[model samples]
Each structure stands twice: as structure tokens, then as C-alpha cells.
Target: MPQGSSKKRERQYEHVKDSAKKRGASESRAKEIAARTVNKERARSGESKQASKTSTQDKKSASQRGGERSHSGSQGPTKDQLYAEAKKRNIEGRSSMNKQQLAKALGR
Candidate 1:
């Protein structure tokens, strides 16, 4: 969001935002995700002052770490992740549904 940032960072932010939006995230949520992602990268690269412990510890880029496990990959969303989404959607009987059932009910 800040001006005068590196081209790479700006591009990363836009990419993240667009990706989130495509994933059906709300505008604010997409922006938040993009900002968090870019900030994490900035912290990892020492471009920002604040550094998260995870960012400091992990040497791999975010993409490199999970590039192969994206939404369209064989590894679908986890049970907990689906549960969180179910909660967001206020799905009924979510507590009783298994991962597959949840995914089916959510039409994912």
C-alpha cells in the first residue's frame, strides 16, 4: 500500500491481492491477506523493521514452501481449515461433518 516501495514488493502485494480475490475473499480480507503476505516477505528480506519468529526462522520463500500445495492441488483444504470456513458461512451441523462432508456441503 505504501508508495516508493520496491517493484518486487509492490508486485507481490498485487499478486497476493488478486489471488485472494479470485479465491472469493472479500475486498477487505483480500487486502489484509495481501498486506500480511507482502509484510512477511519484507520482514524476511529485512525490508521492514518488524520480523515474525516464523519468518525469521524459515529460509524458504512463501511460494517455495507451499507452491505445490495450492488450492487446486491434490492436497485439498484441511479439516480445520474447512471448519473455519464453515464457521464463517454459519453452516449448520458443521461439528458433526467430516472433512469430505464439509467440503461437499460448502460446494468446494
Candidate 2:
């Protein structure tokens, strides 16, 4: 956090950093994620001297987004990821199912 960040911002940063680490991010990556999230929030709330257009104008806060955009590549989550979820859910015929079918079966 930058100098003079409030207690709330400090707590939010720690929370985000710990959550990222729990989700398998490296220590540096986790800290980066936390800082970005906290900074965006600070900008949005006018707590910071400078703010970016996107940071202030985004429709959803970083905390509210809650990874909604994560793993959303050009094709979204990979076929293997879909298949693994299908297997975990005991969806029948998962082995024979194509990526699209697996996604549909899993209600993705």
C-alpha cells in the first residue's frame, strides 16, 4: 500500500493477497494482485491523488468481480479443465464427450 493508506485498505490488501496465495499464486504474484486490486479500489473511491479512466469507471469493483474474468481466455477454460470437472461430478460418458459436450454437460 502507498503511504497513508487507511486501515480498511490495509486489511483489504492483506485479504486479497492471502486469497491469491491460497489459489496457488506465487508470493510476488499474490502481492501484485493484492496491490492492483487495492489500488483500483482506492482510485475508485477517490482516496488516491491519481486515478485511471478504467479504474474509476469500471462497472464492478474488483472484490465484487471475484474472479469472474479469471480463466477466460480466447476459448475460456480448456477442454481438459472441463473434462476434469465432469469426472469429478461423475457425469456419465465423459470420456467420449468432446469439449463442447463436456461443457454443456457440466452446465458451463
Candidate 3:
């Protein structure tokens, strides 16, 4: 937590950090995520002395945006993830399927 942060920000940092860890982020990564989230929030609310352009101008708060951008890579969900879903659903001929076929089979 940053120096002189309010109790609310401190609690928010811990909550975000724990949530990140639960989602399989490493300890360091979790800390970084928490710090960034809290800092951005502080900047948004004008609690900090210095703020970045994007941080202050963002339309949505960190929690409000949620993970809208998560799992949206070059082609969205990875082939492995699609395959696993296909396997669970027992899609026909899934074993011989490529990434696109798996996605199509799984109706992604």
C-alpha cells in the first residue's frame, strides 16, 4: 500500500490482491495488480497528488470494467481451453479438430 493511503484504500488493495491470487496469479503479480488497481482508483478519485492522463480520464472504475479485456487475445480463448470444453461436452471428432474447429464445435 502507498504511504498515507486511507483505510478504505488499504482494504481495497488487500481484497484485489487476494482475488488475483485466487485466480492463479503469482504472489508478485498479485501485489502488482492490487497496487495498480488501488493507485488507479486513487488517481481517479483525486486522492493522490499526481495522476496520469489515462487514469484520470478513464470512463469506468477498475471494478466497473471488471475483466472485460481478459481472455481476449489475438483470437480470443486459446486452443487448449476450447479443446478442454469440447472434450467435456464429448463433441464428435474433437480429437482430430484444429483450433477453429474446436471453437466452432463448442459454439464459441
Instruction: Count clashing residue pairs per candidate.
Output: 0, 0, 0
Q: Which stretches of candidate 2 lie over 4 Å from their true place?
A: 62-108
Query: For residue 4, what is the lDDT in candidate 3?
Result: 99
Instruction: Give candidate 1's TM-score.
Output: 0.53
lDDT of 1 by residue, 67-86 (tens): 64345657678999999999
- Candidate 2 structure quality by residue, lDDT tens digits, 5-104: 9999999999999999999999999999999999998999999999999899889865678877675566877889999999899999999999999999
TM-scores of the models, in the given order?
A: 0.53, 0.58, 0.59
lDDT of 3 by residue, 1-108 (tens): 989999999999999999999999999999999999999999999999999997999897655788665555556788889888998998989889999999888877
Error of 3 at 67 (Å): 8.0
Q: What is the C-alpha local distance difference test score of candidate 1? A: 0.87
